[model samples]
Target: MAGLVWKDIIYIKKMWKTMLFAVLFFILFSFSRNDAVSSMALIAIMVGSNFSMIPFNYDNYSKWNEYQYAFPISRKTAVCSRYLFGVIVFGCCALIYALIMMFQLFIINEIPEKEDLLLQIGVVCFVPVMQSILFPLIYHCGVEQARLYFVAIFALIAMLVIGCSSVIVNMFCEENTIMIIAAMIIIPILLYIFSLRLSINIEQKKMA
Candidate 1:
């Protein structure tokens, strides 16, 4: 499983130029706008989650599925590795964005309020939820087919974030800060578990 995760990292490393460009673009955009903290965070999550698909593309190119089964690894392990890789990638991206936000705030001599930080955390949590939707489709339908639907997936995620943000704003009270934080942590985890199971089942069917 570690090797599998490393394999994905290698693929990402090969695309270093593109990744560098993306980071620069986002950084420039972040600095250009006054109200771009949340938007920058959201873009980081989206880009990082998209990076998770690179390994799948590499696998398809190499017919890795046919060969990977020759080893001791199970379909479940293979599927789980993608999720694990995604978590790492998203975590790194989130950290980078958080630092960027901090720098922005520092430059402006502003301290982030607790609620503002919580909102950022909440938005970050949605990355896994988007991945949960994306990974299953890629595993079951093939990456090429899944790529075609990415626009729709992007739209769906946008709608979900908008809806959730509205609800969070309306329902948030000082007392329920902990509750909101708990929900942000818990919901994405539940969704990931469900998605992992579905992905494992799909991979099993493919292997069988």
Candidate 2:
């Protein structure tokens, strides 16, 4: 497992330019001193899940699944590792971003309160769960279509929820921050579980 992961890192190291640029851009959000930075990291992870598409494509191109066929690892592990690696990649980015945020807050005086750690945590953990929601759909449907579906559906749902919530506030005028936050946390967990089950089923079919 370690070697497989290391090999991926070694491969990624050769492509540091693109990754560094992404890290730099995302870290720029850290200076804002808004909780939304954390949310943005998770959003970055969601977009970054597409990173798996390239490697998956490479595996198909090079016929590397045959090599996995020769190995003794379970098909479950095979599927799970790709997801694991994707998370790891995003986590690394989040860490660097958090550090940048910290520097911006402390050294640059942009944010006096040091909350980058909390923000990083908020972004990092739920990403795997988000991947659980996203990966299977992309895996089975293909990337281009899945990207279209995810962005469109998610944006529509977000707009509808925001619009309706605003209307409710106008009509009844009750603000429940706790309920809102709880719903945000709960929704991701549920989505993750759903994505995991879907991913496993699709992977099993592929192995079949």
lDDT of each: 0.79, 0.60
1-208 in candidate 2: lDDT tens per residue? 6655665666677667877776666656544545455346545654465454556655665667668768777666666666667667656655765676678678877753324333344455545555665678777886667767867765664455345643533433344545544654677667766766677788789766
* Candidate topping TM-score: 1
Best by lDDT: 1
User: What is candidate 1's local distance difference test score?
Assistant: 0.79
Write the residue-wise lDDT of candidate 1 on 123-186 in tens digits: 6787788788889999888998888787587877666655576455455535478888899899
What TM-score, to 2 decimals, does candidate 2 have? Answer: 0.65
Q: How many backbone clashes does candidate 2 have?
A: 1
Model 2, CA-based lDDT: 0.60
Model 2: clashing residue pairs? 132-195
